[model samples]
Target: MSFVRPDIIRPPSEHASYYLPLTSGCSNNSCAFCAFSFTTLGIRDLDDVKREIDAMSLYAKSRMWMAGQPDIVYAILRQWDGKRVFLQDGDALVYPYPRLMEALQYLNAKFPALERIASYATPQDILRRSVQELRDLKKQKLGILYMGVESGDDDVLKKIRKNVSHDQMVEAAKKVKASGILLSVTVILGLGGVAGSEKHALETARILTEMDPDYAGALTLTLIPETELYREWESGRFEMITPFDSLRELKTMVEHSTFSNCFFSSMHASNYFSIRGSMPKDKGKILRQLQALLSRRDPNMLRPEFMRGL
Candidate 1:
């Protein structure tokens, strides 16, 4: 069988020190606003994955040889240029626990000096893994987990068919955190539109504060073609929040938030103004900046539509 290698997938923030992809397709694969199917060009076999790892080893060794230096070799291997590995595709959690463990183990065996590993995981898949199993995986060097919490509004969650609930996300995040793995929860701004925007932001802020994840991300909504959300938008059944309105909602989210020690970011590509600050205390200043921007309504303060991608 032939496996198609995807050229690109959703990547973590540049601020994140390292990112890794462990699997291909998303396990849930039913979010209304998602475009994972469009992006997943192929599925890789287990053996194929091993071969990729082998190729990486050979590549690293060749680079090391070219340098003609033992001291710089470790740096070469550790550099993501040849060192950091991102398990590509949609989500890597689709791999069976044991098989996934085996692949991770093999990677470590090949590159004993690797820095960090990370992947995307749905709440359902993470919940399926026992806490002990997650902890063991952490011990094996899994560093970060990116979870798409989308929105904490239950109605919106049901509408998107996220296949998981707010409570489920909270519990799953707790488990991952308890396992000593860094948890980054994603929230989509403008998810609830102008109608539900306030409630959506408030609920999301409340949930994130409750979960108290290590990192929280906010992304403005951009409707991509072929997804259910796109259809709704095309039909005018869904009213998207304007950039200003979206920013207002983001401000609400920050204002309502109560996270004590969370690093919050809206530095995603789709966002109008990327904001990065710690929560609770910084929330006020962040909201103030956003509100001031909105009050000014300077065209230059907003990101152009062309720059925002789905």
Candidate 2:
């Protein structure tokens, strides 16, 4: 089958990056709350990836355009500063190891000046590769990996079909750190819903401390219409916590999770509020901010429901 190029859905931090598609969809797409759950994974051909790299190189070096190349390539190239490239789709790390390595090698050969390369990787994907393999990729400039650790509570994980256990995710983080790759993980607030909220927050804090990621982000749950979670909500099988309650979970996580110099934030658009700073140092300030907001319980102080996005 021909590879269908995916639309760019990337981390906010990668706004300046060149979107390089090695794979589309996600390897573990069964997460009930995720839009990717309805899609199948697609791996782009190594030759196709190299060709895009070639086109990127040509366009970066001179004002040139390739006739057969997709217009999106040049659209991104026009804005790209040649500093970073973010692999596209959900889990590009799930791209077959040898081919992924070759693609990175090709990218380096074409753009040695590129500073960093990044991708969203599932814990399962990291577990599949050896630390040495990840190290090799890091040497090729794969500097960061964004992982979604949704919830650490076992029940919540099973409910969401995250597949991997908290321990497995901790191991994955260890492997990524051991390989010297900067690990950035994200967890969802209110994933446990009303019934298991406290347990979810505490377990999430525990797991976050265990993983000790270089960066951690907290995102509020925003049910998409077609997702299983949304259906469950409609059927009264799932209960979402209030927005302030979501902030409470965020506060619990921030107050409890210990980090060896980590940047923690709730800056995603899905969040009702944003608080960010280096952990252990700014923990007090962040907590106070949430506390003051929680104390007032002002609806106007929070982001409106209509403004939230997946």
Candidate 3:
């Protein structure tokens, strides 16, 4: 079957990036809370990827539009600055290493002035590659990777079917850092629900400290309809924390997680409130902001459920 290009679902930091796809859906798609659960992974043919690149190059150099190229290509190219390219579809890093290398090589050859390339990578994918392999990709200008740590609490991770252990994620982070690639990881704020919330927050903080990522983000859990977690909530088997409770988890994480100058934030659209700053140095200030909001307990001040998006 021909590959189907997945819709753009990317990290917020990749807003300025040109969306490139080598794969669609996620290789590890069993996470209970994820929208990609049960979706089949699709690998685009190398020639198809090259065709898109060829179209991009032609458009970039001559302002000529290709007849058969997908409109999304030109739609993105119109806004692209031609500096950064973010490989798309959940975890594009899961693309086969040799093909991925060739694609990046072709990308560089076509856009020699490209500043950096990035992709979301599952811990499993990151672990599959050696540090030397990752370094080789870095040499090709693969600058950063966005990893979803989800939750550090083992029980929470197990319940969510995240598949990877906390230790494994830490090791993956280490490998990425060792490869001289900037590591940016995200943890879910309300992942443990009411029952294991505190432990989840503490363990997540511990994991973040161990990883010491260049960037850390906190996203509040937003249940999607048809997802296992959503069904659990509907059946009264799982309990979601309130918005304020999520803020409390955010507070706990910020207070406990030590960082060597990590840029940390709860600025994701799923969050009720946003706080961003350089960790360690800005920890106190961030805590104060959370405290002020938590103390108020004003429902009006928090992002309403109707306004929240995945």
Index of the highest-TM-score prediction: 2
Candidate order by lDDT, decreasing, is 2, 3, 1
lDDT of each: 0.77, 0.95, 0.94
Candidate 1 per-residue lDDT, tens place, 1-310, comes to 4554443455555222223334555667788898874444344567766765665676567743333323322442465453455565566766788888888898889888876677778898799998999998887778778888989999999988898888999999999988998888889999897788888989998888878988999998888789998899899888898888888888888888788688998988899988999876687788779889989988798888788765
Give residue 60's error in model 2 in angstroms: 0.6
Candidate 2 regions exceeding 4 Å error are: none
Residue-by-residue lDDT tens digits, candidate 2, 1-310: 8999998999999999999999999999999999899878999999999988989998988879876898889889889899999998899999999999999999999999999999999999999999999999999999999999998898899999999999999999999999999999999999998999999999999999999999999999999898999999999999999999999999999988999989999999999998999988999999999999999999999988889878
Q: 1-310, model 3: which lDDT tens digit per residue?
A: 9999899999988999999999999999999999989688999999999999999999999999977889999999999999999998899999999999999999999999999999999999999999999999999999999999998899999999999999999999999999999999999988999999999999999999999999999999999999999999999989999889999999999998899989999888899998999978899999999999988899888877777888
Judge candidate 2 at residue 65 and give its lDDT.
87
What's the TM for model 1? 0.88
**C-alpha displacement of 286 in model 2, angstroms?**
0.7
* TM-score attained by model 2: 0.99
TM-score per candidate: 0.88, 0.99, 0.98
Which 10-residue window in model 2 sums to the lowest lDDT?
Answer: 59-68
Cα deviation at 267, candidate 2, in Å, is 0.7
